[model samples]
Target: MTNDHDVVISGASLAGCTAAILLARRGVRVALLERRSDPDAYKVLCTHSITANAHPVLDELGLIPALEKAGALHNDARWYTRWGWIEPRSAPEGPELPYGYNVRRSTLDPLIRARAAETPGVDLLLGHRVTGLVREAGRAVGVHASTPQGDREIRARLVVGADGKDSAVAKFAEVPTTLHENTRFGYLAHFRNLPLQGGIGQTWFLEPDMAYAFPNDDGVTVLAVLPDKKRLPAFKEDLEGSFLEFVRALPEAPPIDSAERISKIIGTVDYPLVTREPTAPGLALIGDAALTGDPLWGVGCGWALQSAHWLAEAAATAAAGRGDLDRSLAVYARTHRRRLRGHQSVAVDFAKARPFNPGERLVFSAAARDESMARHMYMFAARLIGPLRFLNPAALAKAAAVNIRHRSAGVSPAR
Candidate 1:
C-alpha cells in the first residue's frame, strides 16, 4: 500500500523530535505531529535533568554544542543521606568524566523541536492531535489526527506514540499496560542566586521524603521536594511555606530563603508509574508512553532521548524498504525492554514510599566514607549501570568491608 510518510509520530516533544531528526537523517520521511499550537510550549512539571547515560545519544544528535551555547549546565550529582554525603571523587586522569545536562524544558523542548522542523525529511505539523488509529487487518497503518483546519488521516508504514504517560496513541491502539502506585507528591520551582556547590546537583534522601537542587542554565537553580502522601494536607494548606520548611530542614540544604523565586511553585500531586508494551504490528511507543517511572529518580528525560535513538536505529532500515518492518519493530521493542525494565522495576518499588532497607543503609553509609563505593553508587544512580550490576556481590562485599573498617577504627561514618 502507498503511504504518505515513512513514519507518523504523535507528540512533538523530546522523544518525537529526536526520533524525527534521527530518522530523517536516515532518509525516512516523518510526519511530526504536536497537539500544541505554540512553538515554544514545554512540559512544566519535569525534573529537566538528563542523566549521563544519555550523553552519547545527545552527542550523536549534535545537540551538545547547541545545548552548551544555550547555557545548559553539565552537572554531576551529590547525594545526602542520614549517614552523611555520598560525593564521588572525579577521576584525576583518563578520558573525561561523563556528565548530564541541566536545562529547563522551556529551553530544551523548543530547541530540539526547531531542529526537527528544519530537517529535510521532517514535516512538522503543529496543532495536530492524534484522535485515533487508522488500522487495516488489525495493524496500524497511520493515525487519524484532528487539526485546526480539519480532521485528517496521514498514512504511514509505522505509527509511533511519543505522547507521554497518558498516551492517546497507545489508548487508541489498545496496547496492554500495567500501573503501579506512587505514595509521594511533589513540588518544584526555580530560583535565582541559588547556586550549587561545584555546580553539581544534590539529592537528599530524607528516608521516605526527598528533595533536590539542580543548577540549571542562566543562574537558575530548580529546587524540588517529594514528600510522603500523608503530608499532602500540610502542603495543600500552604504550598510555598511548607515547601520552604521541608527543604530548609534538610542537612546542608541550598539557601532557598536568600534566593529570589523566579517561577511559581508547580508540581504533580498524583503521578503513578505507568508501563506499556512498547510495540504492536505497525506501531511503536517511545519515552513515557512505554514506561513512566518514579520522577524522584529523574530518569524520564534521559530515557526519552535514549529510547528515541534506539527506535530510529531499529526502524530506519525497514522504513527505507531495506528490511522487514515487523521484524525491525520487534527488535526495537526488545532493546527497549532490555535496557529499561530493570531500572523501571527498582524505581517502581522505591516509589512505595518506604524508608531505606538494610542493604540501602549499608551502601549509603559506606558510600559516605569510601570513595570507591561512592563512585559505584554514583554510576548506578546516574543509570550508567543497571541494578543487577550495581548490586553485584563484589560491590556489596566492598560496602561491607568499608563499614567494618570504619567501625574497627572507631571512625564515625557521618560528619
Candidate 2:
C-alpha cells in the first residue's frame, strides 16, 4: 500500500529533523523516516559544535531556549598563531557575530528528533530502514522502506536525503560526488575541571598540528588534536599518553594535563572531504549527505542546519503553490553551490596536513597584530562570512604593511 505525503525525508539527524520542523510549521505535509528507533541516538563521532550560521534556523524553530535549558554552551572562539592570539574585538552583542553552539551529540540528537515529532504536520516514522528510491520518469518520488511490521511504500512530491557521508539516498539516485583525499587523522576526548575560559573556545595552530579546547556545558572542555599521518607512530603505541604529551607540547598549552578526562579518547584515521550536487530531479541532499568537508573547522552541524533551512524555504514555497517544485529544487542547488563550494575547496586544501605557506604565515602574523585583519580572520573562522570576496590585493598590502612595521621594531615576521 502507498502512504503519501508532500515530502519524505530520510535520516532524522540535525538536517532531516530540522527540515521536518520547518516544513511542519509551514503546514506542509512531511514524513521523516529515521532508521534509528531509540530516541537518544546521535552521531557519537561528531564534535557537536555548530557555528553562528545556524542562529536563524534555531531562532525560527524556537530551539535556542531549549538548547540553553539543556546546557548548551555559546562558544566564543580564540585563534592562536605563532605571533600571538588573534581575538575578535567585541561587537555589541547581536546575531551578526552570534556565539556558536556546543552540545553533546547524545543530548542534542534526541532533542532535535523529539521537537520535530511534536510539530503538527509531521509524521515521524522512526525505525524505518530505507531500501531504495521510488522513482518515476527519472525523478525521485519517495522511498521503499522496511518497518518492523512489514515493507512500506512511501510516495511524495519530493524526497530529501539527509543521510551522512555514505548516504543511501545519494547512492540510490546515482548522484555523482567529488571526493578529495584528506591526509590527516584526528582524535578527541572530554575532560573535566579544565581551567575556566568564561565560555571562550581556544584553538592553537602549530603549523600542521591543530588542537582545540572548546569549553562546553557541564564544566567540561572537549580537547581535540588533528595531526599529519606521519606523526601517527607515537600515538599507535600509547593513545592516551601520546595525546597528553602532544597537548603539553603546544605553545602555552591550555592546562589540559591538570584536568581529569571524562570520556575515552575517540578518533578517525582517514576520511575524505566530499561534495555533492544538492538537488536533482525530485530529490535533494542536505548536510553531510551533500558536503562533508574537513571536520577540523567544525562547520558540519551549522551547514546541516543551514542547508535544512534552505531546503525548507524552497520546499515550503512549492508546497504552498507559489512555484514549480522543480524550479524550487534548482534554486536550492544554485544557492547551495554558490555558498558552500568555495569553503569546501579551501577546506580540502588545508586537509592535506601541510604547513602554512608563506602567504598564510603573512596573514596569521598580520592578523595577530592588526585588529581589522583579526576581525576578518575571526569572521571567516566562525563561518559568519566567506573570505574570497575581500581577501585581495588591498588585504595583502595591509598585511605587508603590518609585517614591515613588525620588522622595523625587531620583531620576526617569519611565523
Per-candidate RMSD vs. true structure? 1.4, 2.1
- State TM-scores per candidate: 0.98, 0.95
lDDT of 1 by residue, 316-349 (tens): 9898677899999999999999999999988888
Best by TM-score: 1
Q: For model 1, what is the error of residue 273's alpha carbon versus the real structure, in angstroms, after optimal superposition? A: 0.7
In model 2, residue pairs whose N, Cα or C atoms come closer than 3 Å (at least 3 residues apart or on different chains), thus clashing, are none
How far does residue 338 in candidate 2 sit from its true spot (Å)?
0.4
- lDDT against the true structure, per candidate, is 0.92, 0.85
**Candidate 2: tens digits of C-alpha lDDT, residues 31-72:** 999998887788878767888878888889888998999899
Which whole-number lDDT from 0 to 100 does residue 232 have in model 1? 99
Error of 1 at 121 (Å): 0.7
